[model samples]
Target: MNDNFENLFENSEYSKTIKKGQLIEASVIEITDDHAVLNAGLKSESFVGLNQFKNPGGEIEIEVGDSVKVVIEEIENGDGTTRLSRQKAKNETTWSNIIRAMNEDEIIEGHIQTRVKGGFTVLIDQINAFLPGSLVDVRPVRDTQYLEGTVSEFKIIKAERKTNNIVVSRKGALQGDSLENKSEIISKLTEGQIIEGIVKNLTDYGAFIDLGGLDGLLHITDIAWKKIKHPSEILSMADKVKVKIISIDREKFRVSLGLKQLDEDPWKKIISNYEIGNKIDCMISNITDYGLFVEIEEGIEGLVHVSEINWTNSNPNPYKIANIGDQVTVMILDIDNEKRRVSLGIKQCKDNPWDSFANNNNIGDKITGKIKSITDFGIFVELDGEIDGLIHISDISWNNEDNIDLSQYKKSDEIESSILAIEAKRQRISLGIKQLNKDVFMEFNQSNSKGSIVKGIISEVDEKNALVLIENEIKGILNISEVSRDKVEDMRTVFKQNDEIEAKIIGSDKKNRTLKLSIKAKEEKEEREAIDSYKADEKESISKTSLGELLKSKFKKD
Candidate 1:
């Protein structure tokens, strides 16, 4: 028996020397409920905990005659057994893999185990590695809990077996994958290609979409056919959407995407769908100081300018008449297809009161209306059917006076007037209240003649002349030299308002409606008549009496 044992020991695989902390290949010799026996080139069979050979779910993964790599923790023990560890073996192998990955610039898979100070701890196989917060992902992670227990690929940036230090980067791996994806996507990308993507972020000018590992810009204008102030109005973060590729820059890795290009342009057939003067119902979409924007159809809108809101009001307030979300009827006045603009008018759908009024009335037609508004220059009269006619201050009376106050014609006061003119294009009506009466100058011209005596009252007096009101409302002028047949410095001193006086008309201008009166000529004519009468009396007395009786009367008078 002794001779047979020596022969077996000399040829056995464990006859070679083995040391602790050394890795060696082993084979499972036996397995039990609590322990596993492994032949690891040792003098005696090594025993390890059975749990080491079991998976996380407590299921045995190793059986008899199965091969595995193990680390020797003890060469010999007092119990006549060698100590071996499967976990230690796995940890050493994991460190070797990580170091190799770092050298070869390869990626390894790992699970984020837990968050630690300044970073997170990741478990790769059975070894723990450090993952800095900055290297976790391409974007900053607000909550580290989200990454816990999640399996992700990582790039080993550093590895040290002496100090048991290892560092990995998720961001580096993602960046490498992104570069590959970007290059491939750019090579295959063509204009007009439809693709799906997730909305990554939104900005004032546009939205960024993520197509797998690449990012593209979706401009705000391409979001829809209608006008939008921002991209958030139509899309939100992380929304999935289908978009068309508009352009691509290979060198810059820039892509432009469009969502509206997938649909037909609404303005392409606008002319065929709508015509001038066609009435349509629309909803107010927006309001501005200049006009109202009404949407006639989806993605199609027209402008109802302030001037087109009403016939009478040239400067109408669009907000006062309509608001956002209000429905209204409008007429298509004009359309420019190339510009994609439609000029709409709310009043065009209704009866134009000015046009109707002009058709019914002619020049010199008498009409009665209420004063709608009064100003220093004119008064606006509201006629029938909401038509307004302007009665200028000069047309209010026969006299042309600059200081004619229009305050007397209050708003809503009844007044009679005649239409003098109509400007259809400008939507203006000229009216005259004084035109209802005959012109006073025409009557005065028929009765008065030059060099005729007339009586008048001083209506206005100035330094140069006195304005006199003659018969039939005729106005006359008397110069200062003609006042009282005497030289006068100022006519205002010789004449007072409403003073009655007699004078001779020296000049009469029928066209100008002016009569020139002279008091000096009248006084001179009366003086000459008195002298002639005295001469006639003296001649008769002399003829009746005699030369001697006349001499004696002269001597007595002396």
Candidate 2:
């Protein structure tokens, strides 16, 4: 009995030695409504709140005889019960685990609870840890509200047990994972390798793609076979796309991706698909000041220049004739495989007006039309089929003395003309109004000949010559040398307009329609006739009288 009493005193001494803030391993002995009795190697039984042994969902987490870690808050109280806490013990263990994770470079899982001034409060095993805004992700997070209630792994970068300060980074953990993924991707990457990626960002020149954890570039030109103004036209942010690796630079860590490479190059079979002078229907994809871009097929386009829009209309504006998304017929004017250029013509698909007019008519064929426009040099007549023929100013009238007033002939005036020439290549048609009637110069040549005496009135008197009108229609000229058989200084002084005169034609050119008249020839002919008359009268008188009587009569008269 004495040995038992000595052991009891030893147990009491041990309970007195138990101090506050001490972590001790204990086993749950009994459970009640409000308290859990625990055996912690102390003389007296310790009690912990039953709430500490329950999970957040109000279920019992610890049963009887279950091992638990706790802190001694009091050794001996007035009620002779040892006070203990389970939360303090859990906090101490969490700090120890965090320090070990930091030393081992391990990642810890945490839930973002709330936002703070410069960072977010994350609950790591019931202990609050700081997550800076800059380190939330690999990229900047514009909205932190999305992170609430999200559980993510993080790396403990800063830890101070005394101050209870801990800082964690989600970006650091992501970068660590990226390094491992990047190495594997780089080793396996090769040209012409097909892969899938997400569109991360966009720029003017290209788009950045996230291939797993690696970033690659998809240039604007490589997005599609056709032209694109920006990357957003073909792709949007966070869109999943399949691409082909066109090139790779390991030293610079750059990868060039292409979406068009997976499909066939349209230019490879362009020559076989199209040919010169072949007609085909196309859709207008784009319009510019110089031309229209026509789509022959998907990713295949041809240029229809402004010059090729029509045959008759020069300087055709593309905007006035067609707009975007219009269907039109075109003929392939040219094809260049090396340059990947196809020249198309909208006019070639239609019948050429000049060729049609030339084939139906011949020179000197008379046709009637209305004057469409008038210029200083000529008038444009619109004939059948909307074709225009030009009548030059010189061909408008037959009389050289009269100048036709073009202003008198207004637009839409009906006029008759004869086709003179047709230039199919130049798309020009020449018409003459004078050709509708017989040529007056031809008739003049048939009636008059050289050295013929003609009488007419002077129509024009100049220093060089005196123009005379014969038959009131034909014109003749009297040179200065032929004016009255004298050396005249000026023909105008000797003759005036409308003066009636008789002259002999000295020269005539039927082809050139020129008549040369001389007054000197007429005067010389009259003199010769008078001399012949006098000789005849003298001869008759001599025959009637004798030589002696004739001489005596002549001497008496003298």
Candidate 3:
């Protein structure tokens, strides 16, 4: 019984030699290549790293047989040796110091090693801590690259032993500075005061002005006397600007400032210097659809409407009359000091051409002019002044083969035209050089009667009728009735404009300027009847079919 008891006691004593995570006082017994054997007052010596022999300062403080507290990291494994950690025990003491510093709310000095996504990692003693970028400085920093390798003071905002995380805020320290700066700024700040300040930050709508210690909002609207598109247009980061304090909120420490108020208003002094009907020279600033905006003085602009540009022209383009940067003299038609607007006129600065034209011309005076334009029914001629006269096609001739060729006349063509009529109230004049010549019908009246046969060219052909121009002042109309006694197909295929043909004048009225001529009627009676029958059949065929069916038939043939 005694031997069995001794055997159990021996086994129990062997088992009590060492265990994992056991705190023990140990002595450095021997040093090897990478590890050291420490005597922990047990039967087995524990193995520790060689690096544990030296302090963080690179000094080997522990000597052989020197005692130190150690933590058992592992028990014997396959190699049969106990693992020990001296540094782990020393870390416990460091943690205690950190906790004490945190509780006391003390500022810790640390070196920032590397940057992470949101912040930089700082080495505080033997621990890794996070220093957020927002808390890095007194103001927000755009680039955090300069923080690497920099040593800074921070207050521990969060620390946890289990998680091994410590969050330090340099912003809290910066906030202290901001408060001090703010106090300094407010000491000298007041409403209705102007001072210089640095632009700290720019927002989409405005900028925050740093007036030494406090930040005041400088709205984009207040930054310029004129309209601005964005806050960045006038203010940029760190820009020094003169600002006027418009208001202050003592409770919230809010400040309102204006930048444009420093400049003098030009409108206030502009009206006193100028008056209506005064002619002033100015440069065309901008041309718009409605008018032209001209700058008459510095910061003072006026409008010259399209109607005011030229009295004689209608629907005149502002671009044609006034180009950008063109120097022009204008008369001030009206001015409204309260509305800050000046009405200007370009034509008022010059003489009215129409007024002078009306005074010089009358309805009956015969004058020579040049042909300006020719239309289907009349010829327009430019008279002695800027006036234009129209001679109707009816007045061009009194008989066939005596009609004038107006197409031979062109714009600015020099010719002799008679002044047939004029209306000054309506600002119109009637001129006819053709009428001044001997009347063709009266000259031929004695020889050719109402049934006279004449030869002329087909000067104009239309869907309705054809016109024959003969003598220099005579024209005859061949109506659709004359083109065909009954019906006719496409006129394009039969006769084109300017074709010459012979036609008998069936009737004439000299006073009313009317003439009747015919071509198909001059054909044989049988041929005319056959053509009329064919035309009637073609018209009936077209009327019977829908347009879509006709087009489909045509497309199919193609």
Candidate 4:
């Protein structure tokens, strides 16, 4: 009874010594899927959650008889059992290490677990630490999702043991590491050292590759000989790639890498493979508003400008001309090796319609086509061979040159026209609808000569002259002074509109393409012709009478 009382008193003393939240070492006595029983010199074994005994991969890491540190959350609750937490014990130790790191300015390893408000929560030695957005990297990073679940080094910037608050800066750690190894990495790098690296970050202009101790830039242009707008097109974060060191700027600590430098430059063989004016078949790879990019070969593309897509139409739509992946024939207009550019022409591969039309047709030849478009200035007619001919308003009719009625001509109206001009070099075809019929002026000129009398109706009368519509389609002007060789004050008084008048074509005025007619000259010419005819008849009668008298005398003498 005496030994039992002593044992109870010793047990009470041990229980008093075991305070709540005190981290203590314990040995695992039994372990199951849900709980682990640990003995920590207590009245009863404490049960620990089996989940806390698991490693990061979720496998149970502790077994029976293994010593593990645990924290006592409750020494004695309503029941007789003691509650213990394995994770809390680990966190306490980790917090102490974090505080030491902050005081000593030391770097530690961490795993970015998830994104939280204003920053991320990083797991450092089983304790959650705050990582601000600004301190995630040495430079600002818009996308930090790639860092999730990734292990990185960080420096403890702030730590509070009472509140269990810890803050870390990955940028500080990264900057320190870079400065320590930058000189060593730069020393070994040569002008053309081929090395392997991981794609650390991507930007529009290039990608930064992690070369063990430093970051090297792989420009978009050096990614491939062909064009790429962004580095993300070919590379992703953490992708391993082999590149050649193109250049090194040790003063600025910048390294330039090139992926294409490993391969032979295809442009070096361009002279043997291609030349200017060389016709070849290609596939359209891309289409833009300005032009189409055609793939000549691997890593080589040539631009076919909109102007070079067709022969007749200037500034044709690239989408209408061809689509992506369409096979087309193009002529190599130029090959600039120095610039690594090629000027290709789609129109040069086909026959020029202007040259073809000029060779097949001539001026004054009648052409039949449907009017494609009608405007006030002209009519664009769709002629043979998909060519277009323009009939200006002035060439639409014979007499309505000044005032034209566009309502008469409609789109898709079939009409017959004569080719007035064909400028092959300019790729212009001038058509005339009026030229298909006989010209009124030419008809009058061919039928009548100078001084010929012609009859016409006065269509318009003014003080200066009377406008006569000769032959319905031809117009002539008769001035007031030439009306009757008399002083004519007003032409309207002498010649009324719609009145029949006879006039002589005294001369031609080619400036206005009109004939100068005179009524006085016509009347005078008629009088002179009548007098001359009378005199000729009288002479013939007198000669006949003289001959008869001489013959009668001769007959009487005989």
lDDT for each residue of candidate 1 in 141-253, tens digit (9 for 90 to 100): 78778888889999876566777788888997888755567799778878999999988556677887877656788999999988888999999867999999999988878
Candidate 2 stretches greater than 4 Å from native? 1-185, 267-277, 458-467, 477-481, 486-499, 507-516, 526-558
* Model 1 misplacement above 4 A: 1-178, 403-405, 456-469, 473-477, 483-502, 508-514, 522-558
Per-residue alpha-carbon lDDT of candidate 2 for residues 1-558, written as tens digits (9 for 90 to 100): 256754685678665566899888999999999999998877567888888877645888998999999999887688866788998998889888887766444688888898999989999878999998988989987987989888999977667677778888788687774546667877789999999998855667777777765678899989988877898899986799999999998765668999989999988767677778889998999999999999987888899999899878867889999989999999998888788889999988888888899899999899999999999888999977677999998788765524578778889999899999998888788999888887776676667677678899998888988888888377788889888766789988888889999988888754445688889997887788899999999998887788779889999999
lDDT of each structure? 0.84, 0.84, 0.74, 0.85
Compute the lDDT for candidate 1. Answer: 0.84
TM-score of each: 0.60, 0.60, 0.43, 0.63
How much is 325 displaced in model 2, in angstroms? 1.6
TM-score of 3: 0.43
lDDT of 3 by residue, 114-204 (tens): 9897888988765789887777887888988887988788766656688888877787555653445656767688888998998755555
Error of 1 at 87 (Å): 51
Residue 447, model 4: lDDT of 84
lDDT of 1 at 131: 93
The residue-by-residue lDDT of candidate 4 on 1-558, one tens digit each, is: 256754684578766777998989999999877999998877677888899988887889998999999999987677867799999998888887886665444689998999999999999978889999988998999999999999999977667667677888899688875554778888999988999998765656788787875778899999988787888878986799999999999976789999988888777666778989899999998999999999898778999999898887779888876889999999999988788899999888888888999999999999889989988698999987788999998888776566668888878989899999999898889999888787777778878889899989998898999888888467788988788877888887766889999999988765466788899999999999999999999999999999999999999999
In candidate 3 the C-alpha lDDT for residue 134 amounts to: 77
* Clashing residue pairs for model 1: none
